[model samples]
Target chain A: MELEALSVGQYSFIQNAYSFGFAVMAAATLFFWLMKSEIAPAYRLAITITGLVTAVAAYHYLQIMLSWGAAVDVTSGEVISTGKPFNQAYRYVDWLLTVPLLLIELILVMRLSRQETIKRTTVLGGAAALMIVLGYPGEVSSAGGLRFVFWVLSMIPFVYIVYQLVVGLKESISQQPESVKNLINISVYLVIGSWLFYPIVYLFPLVGLEGGAAITAVEVGYTVADIVAKAVFGVFIFMIAMRKSQEIEGTASTVSKPAAAAENETSKPS
Target chain B: MELEALSVGQYSFIQNAYSFGFAVMAAATLFFWLMKSEIAPAYRLAITITGLVTAVAAYHYLQIMLSWGAAVDVTSGEVISTGKPFNQAYRYVDWLLTVPLLLIELILVMRLSRQETIKRTTVLGGAAALMIVLGYPGEVSSAGGLRFVFWVLSMIPFVYIVYQLVVGLKESISQQPESVKNLINISVYLVIGSWLFYPIVYLFPLVGLEGGAAITAVEVGYTVADIVAKAVFGVFIFMIAMRKSQEIEGTASTVSKPAAAAENETSKPS
Candidate 1:
């Protein structure tokens, strides 16, 4: 991708966003890891995957910050190109690894049947990967038409994942304990809504925003979406897990030890 | 770590070992990956772990080669430093990841019971990690006595692993099918023997050898031990897995798949 020059204000905004994104992701990772033992064994892997997602995002955000520093020149009192490329691919790479993982953590938190879990994750996770792969060509393309082509192509899988989350997982979500059902439902919608934010940002240049404005909007937009999708969603996962564990514990206490394992269907998600 | 300067001949020798080590490890990684499905599902995890060990080794060897290139100045003809430190920690880092994996792969090939598998892997893999970690401080220490102290500390774990492989696994080895019993036993010995070679190499500087010869001996020694320990042992693991699969197939045909799972056990190693 061609590099973009920015005004000092635009440059400062992106730099701050990158720094804040890293801090949020890093914080989420630490939060998940530290809170892991509070959840039931069955839900811990969901938290672990959540941790992994945030950790991967934190690493990429750090990389993006470093790349931005190397590729931008501010010593002249204005933002100028440093003749080195800012690796926009870092965001795509982060999304590629974490998006599928995002779907997986949600699937895990639902405690679906083994075959159902495998089937949904295989289809949905594979779709998430395909969506990202299809989107990348357009992401790096200079031509607006080519970018739009990939946008449409990627949307096929994007829509599939959204549908799978909203409709296909309805049964599983309903079966979750009363305390966590709404939590999961809200988290699912949060994923779909945050993900929708991604493509709109992808269209910044195509929407006639140019140069610094377009780049700034895209960078800041993606940063905001990432925090909402990963960190905020992670907090929701933590909440759902806490609620589910309490459900399991409450049932265990009322019905005695025999019912302890009735709710924790799966030991670990794939 | 203090950097070591080398003679031209020593530099060339160490360089060749680094290059050849990379090729060996990469080739083993490819071989194990390609042959994964050929093994019984029960033993394929062993193959996968083997692949991981070699893959990690390949990556570190590549890093070592790059570090070597950047640290050495060949323009002087006689060996000279570029003032950039050659990172010797790559070897320890590689061991930290792959050594535990090496132990786990062997346990998987044996197909021990779930409890047995978990217990052995926890104890042995943990010991392997401790061995590597303890050795690192000594490897980097300038004082021979301090190095020797760490060596002794690391040996505590090393001997435990060797004993676990030989004496502790005696019953597991005996229960193996006719075809793979000796194969497992031989691989066990191979591990114990190859591991011994590492400490010998670690002691090179403490011995009479000094300067270029000591660095060359240690480098070449560690590289050879790595190939034998990882690549060669991986091949042994592959052979054992192949034999176990064949045993499963042979019994599967006669007993009509009521025994398809007879020899194979534990779907995946941790």
Candidate 2:
């Protein structure tokens, strides 16, 4: 199965998949931004960042879909020979914008200290962006070895990201309210698990999938991963934020009582 | 464009879209079932039913995808004439099982009286299932007039469902805690809004869309609607359940003071 043998129908399918993903992401963005909630400021920022991540991805996916559609003859479902090539770079562009924000938002929702948040966000966010940038050459490369080389280069940052999330954040996560500790752990695992799909999709060509099947697998695979990473993960983020907000409120109500008692005694007969 | 002019690529796209939707639904089902939460039993049942809805839809969608994939000659991206006809019936089958569960779940989460639950679930669920059954004949009919007639028949039940959800549930929803009241309203609206898409998709052919375009529109449209109806709506259900659970706890602590005081009096030195 050579690249030239890829049908226009496959491209249409890919384009439509992207289009669907974009629509969902855009809707989620609106939801996270517009929905009423009494969550804390830190978590509110997390929600806003979640929306931004999806919005950016939605914009890029729209571009990717357009590029794919432009390359196909819609009526016949055939790839036009003379049309502009499908812009695969749009994915990398999306990742560059979203990957860092993904880490930053997660850190924000944790409501860690300013120093800790800054440290983790800088290290993890930078690594995430670097991972995407490193993966780009491989994504666009036709040569198998070049793709593999860039993939390996990209994995370094990915591994670092996993470490920062899993190991570096361990103590802080452990100190979170018991209700949301498990949720935070699950969110971390969700991020790590969904992300692993990208590398597998990247390596599909090496596994003997070529042309239409490979393209279909890659496109479908990425779309699935994108939904999980953006929409589903956003749901988890919102849940965590809600739980943490409740916890803060509960603590404030309990802790304010002693202070109120002391103020009553001081003011009563002085 | 005639239905026969529907291209292999279009079918491939539709099949893949269904597959993606199935994967997400299955994952969501598991999340609802397995995730740790402190929601009440009524709400927990709601969560379980949410899972069941998606799980059934996912299974049927898998069958639909397989039927579509079997019809396609993957290598050439062409639909084979002799292959098993794409199982449009699977959608109806799925709706029969899940649509009723969807209504029942919403009623259960509202924690209505047993009689009210039964009454609402029976009327709403029965209407929902009937709506799907009525629409199926229209979906399969070649004659435009027959399809239109069946579609009109289906809308009767749809209007009934809207009435029950919006009007019948009004008092019960109003009695819910303030935190969850808006959510219940939104959930009802979400259900009605997402459902309206199905009728629109059914009537697309009547509006001059035909062949590949109509098929594409219908499949993609239904896929989007399904995601919203099941997955996105489930998220709202979970949120409402969480808030209600918190409210229940809050009220229990505050309202139990009299009983505690009475017990203290009974146990005193007298």
Candidate 3:
């Protein structure tokens, strides 16, 4: 891309956008690095890396935006006429970065759940992965057919996630602590809400939105919500994992208390 | 907020945005409600009320978008400009709903911390409150001055929050659970990162972003990060809260266990 040749203003836009992207990537990377020793750090790492890569792509695009702003539009390759090449390049990078992250997160969730013997984790994780993969064609396609395919793929994960949540709730209803239940319920809503965003972004514009504005608005909105749901929600899930680990430790101590006390008494004089 | 006459497309764009907004609001409300007995139920009620209001306002904006799209752009304001006005109106409502919620969450944390006799909670909570109040001006003002004010104000909570976490680490240096420490650290980064976003968004555009596109991009990125931080981080807080409460209960049970056993032995016949 002609990033090196941009005007001062374009350079600033790119710099700012890139800086923002860098912050995201750096934070994600650092967070994962810190979490590496935990039970399921790979998923966290993948997610963070995705976030990091996305930030890098975003920064590049911001650079493009700065340069292209004076000449034409950011997406349609409008303003500078020369801007299309760079814009498309960045857009492709953005997609490539995000899609894999989504897949990795799903796989990680699946593996973790399987370890915990949660059957639904695999199904839901697979569905989420499938949805992401299927949606790609629609995402990259010009003709709405790719979108339709993507929507169907995406819906599977949404449904699976909701299903896993429902099952989790039912299982928890018997003996789960209120906090655990709350975590599960809230996490479900977050994931579901995120999944629902795709269709809303893709299909909602059919009514009255003209040209690229609707798409732009949808993209912007979804990106914001997605980031929030993934990162923030990911944190919550980690907390839950930790909480569960703690509970197991607590139970172990409780169960061993009597035996430990008897052994202590035996060592003392009668 | 001329929202009565919407074309299908404009209506859809506005509707989808509002839908996502409503989902977030609803999830937050549900979470607050679930934890009402622990925190203040009143706050949850307030959030619910605010969310409902946002939903209504969203509906109104959808109509406005529809009308704007359907009508020709009359520069003289001859034909009602539904687009910008409604969009601004929606943004205003969003600000009203969220800013208050942020403050409320901080207050709730302070109140709970006080009840638990955690000194840092009160101080940190107070700082957060002050920041939220300061952010109001920043939220409203489009000027660099206002933005700077809000930026500084917002930073205060982050600083306080970090202080609180660091102190927690210091207090429990030897005994602090790895999970708790990791969670706290993640939160510190997430919150601080979000706090830094406003300046970047405002300042970056001055260099090159002539149109609203770059500003919008920054806003979108900020919103995504912020939402993730708040809601997702909020979940971690919830998990921690639940864990803490459970720990409290466990301690209570352990403390009373021997006494109860002794009482039972004394009452039994020889």
DockQ of each: 0.04, 0.05, 0.03
Using DockQ, rank the candidates from best to worst.
Answer: 2, 1, 3
Error of 3 at B215 (Å): 22
| Candidate 2 C-alpha lDDT tens digits along A94-189 | 899998998898898888999999898999899999999999988788889999999999999999899988998999999887767877898899
- By lDDT, rank the candidates, best first: 1, 2, 3
lDDT by residue for model 2 over B1-270, one digit each (tens)? Answer: 243456867866777789889988888877776652556432565676677677767766776676566444544654544332454666676686678778877886776543466578889888998998898778777689999999999999999899988888887787665667898889899999999998888887787777787788788888888888888888788787777666555544655432223222222222
Once model 1 is optimally superposed onto the true structure by TM-score, how far is the C-alpha of residue A35 displaced, in angstroms?
0.7
What lDDT score goes with residue B14 in model 3? 43
Q: Write the number of the candidate with greater TM-score, choosing between 1 and 3.
A: 1
Model number with the top lDDT: 1
Cα lDDT tens digits, model 3, B1-270, are 233333334444444544454466446536644563452221232232223333323332343344335432433334333232222322333333343344334333222212222244345546655655565555445576766766776776656655655564344322333434455456555665665665566455335553434533543554455455456556645554444444434444666443223222222222
Indicate whether candidate 2 or candidate 3 has the larger DockQ.
Answer: 2
lDDT of each: 0.79, 0.73, 0.44
Residue A92 error for model 3, in Å? 9.2
**Higher-ranked by DockQ: 1 or 3:** 1
| Candidate 1, TM-score of its B chain | 0.90
